[model samples]
Target: MEFFFYAVPSLMIAGFAAAAYLLVRRARRLRRTWTHGLTAEARCLRMFTTAGGGGGDTSVHTTVHHVYEFTTREGRTVRFEEENGPTTVLEGDFVTVRYLPELPQRATALPPTPGRLAVGTGVGLVFLGIAGSFCVGFILLVHVIFAESDGLLP
Candidate 1:
């Protein structure tokens, strides 16, 4: 029973660590791909409206229309849809996009900013660390609580 108690929490912590590592790794790879600049082409498809709350703390709801599109570049095509904001590209206009080479399907019209990427990655890793820690702590707490309640712990 003692061994199981230790083993279960250990496994939980290990699993959380692995998941957090994977997320950070993926974010880093994406950041790198953004830096290198992958080829992409974009064109606006249409526009649609969506509702959102307004500013001034008045909580006024309003509908806004934004452009949508089908973009193709580097042998991959994706719908470049935007909502509630004006896109730089217009309908029937061809535009270039940059993306991670590994994930050609995920393209962005904007250029990569290394500073922003670094900040984003750092923040993401921090958040992941916090989340993982919370998960591990929760798992251990639950196990200990249950064990004590059941008189399983000597």
Candidate 2:
């Protein structure tokens, strides 16, 4: 019982911290790639749907995958897939592709809408908030536990 009293909160704190880290890292990468990437005309090669889901307590979902290919100014052909793209796009349609010149393979099929960046940032901030709450809760828990042991908390 004592072990669980401390372990549960510790696990929650760790999980939230890890989630916040991953969210922030992804948000930063997406923002950087879109902001600094070079542009080229890419053609939609094909489209497919993939089954994706978060496990345990999360719901399962399907993702529409868009495969696009573009040729670099250096004549190198690069192909990439994106799950979040406008639904009106079809095979053979030309779209704007953004990529780092040095890493053309990591190109984006479509530019994010104005709200996309804000949404990513907002989600990351929420995760950070949850992590902060857990940290503060854990610290207070520890202080209360120790204070009770010393008869300072009654």
Q: Score every model by TM-score.
A: 0.50, 0.70
lDDT value, residue 86 of candidate 1: 47
What's the lDDT for residue 62 in model 2? 76
- Residues 1-154 of candidate 1: C-alpha lDDT, one tens digit per residue: 5567557666766876787787778667657667785565566566555656666786766554433344444444566443433445456666566666566555555455668667876787787678767767776786788778784544
Q: What number of clashing residue pairs does each candidate have, in the order they appear?
A: 0, 0
Model 2: residues with Cα > 4 Å off, grouped in runs: 1-8, 51-60, 135-139, 142-154
lDDT, candidate 1, residue 71?
Answer: 40
lDDT of 2 by residue, 54-144 (tens): 7999888877889999998889999888886877898899999888888898788666664777787687778678776877687688768
| lDDT (CA) per prediction | 0.61, 0.79
